[model samples]
Target: MSTRTDEVERYEHLWQEPAYPHRWVLWDTAGDVLVFDRETNCLVDFDDESVLPDVLGRMRAAGVPESGDYPGRPCA
Candidate 1:
């Protein structure tokens, strides 16, 4: 049986691949951006504009396209 750590490792490996599936971006009411990884049920919140470039870089590394704007449902 796989432990939780093993599952997490698997997800991490998957995330390193190009065009990893089920990854999405969401905007909060406050206008911050959040990266949602469906496979891992993880949310990476970007609360500062200064970190946007870094965030975008990470997104690209994860095979998600970079866009000036992302259309999606707002987070409550």
Candidate 2:
């Protein structure tokens, strides 16, 4: 499979299961953004701000609670 396809598959697998007892947040590092999976401490690269709405939409559709405004904090 192509690299892009592989990447997409990886991304899906990353979020395939919810991280219970641990919340997630979009960590903005100024240079880029990422989905910080608190339970696993997994940091998935998120390069665009435009995709936030769509991502959050999908999360809500999947029954995940909606998030508030961007924290705008640097990735620790």
Candidate 3:
């Protein structure tokens, strides 16, 4: 998402899952770009296959900034 060369920081947008606003849970967005669950605070390799291209494709079309890396399952 934001890792794309076409994307920029500062103006870089932060993305989140709104349905769980009170949960403080971050979106595990690696599944949308890389197949594996990326660990918390880790940098993601955008070309990884763990991502779901279909979802990214749709969101990219809507101009939504891709989410930042997040914690995987069992986040404490």
Candidate 4:
């Protein structure tokens, strides 16, 4: 199993300026959801099935769109 830090590092290279000021939501190659925060320079991997809705809720609250059709579907 990959650690959260490991997962963040794995996807760091794909980071770009977000459409919103401080937060961006995306999915990994394996269709796992991830959220990146510019203010904290932190990446959150939502690997837990139960916490996905809450994670998305927080992201939406942070200004990320609540649409399933994000810019890149499978942001690897």
Arrange candidates by lDDT, highest first: which order?
Answer: 2, 1, 4, 3
lDDT of 2 by residue, 1-76 (tens): 4554443444453344665542565555665445666555666455554555556444445554324445334458
What TM-score does candidate 2 get on C-alpha atoms? 0.39
lDDT of 3 by residue, 8-74 (tens): 2221222233332212222445453432323343333344343335434543554443345444454
lDDT of each: 0.48, 0.50, 0.36, 0.47
Q: Say which prediction, candidate 1 or candidate 3, comes out ahead on lDDT.
A: 1
Select the stronger candidate by lDDT from 2 and 3.
2
For 26-72, candidate 4 gives per-residue lDDT tens digits of 43434656564444445554445455555555445545643333333
Model 4 TM-score (2 dp): 0.35
Give the number of the best model, judged by TM-score.
2
Model 2, residue pairs in steric clash? none
On lDDT, the leading prediction is: 2
Worst 10 residues of 4 by lDDT: 66-75
Query: Residue 28 in model 3: shift from native, Å?
Result: 9.6
RMSD of each: 8.5, 5.9, 11.7, 9.2
Candidate 3 CA-lDDT value: 0.36
Cα deviation of 59, candidate 4, in Å: 0.6
Using lDDT as the yardstick, the better of models 3 and 4 is 4
Q: State the number of backbone clashes in model 2.
A: 0
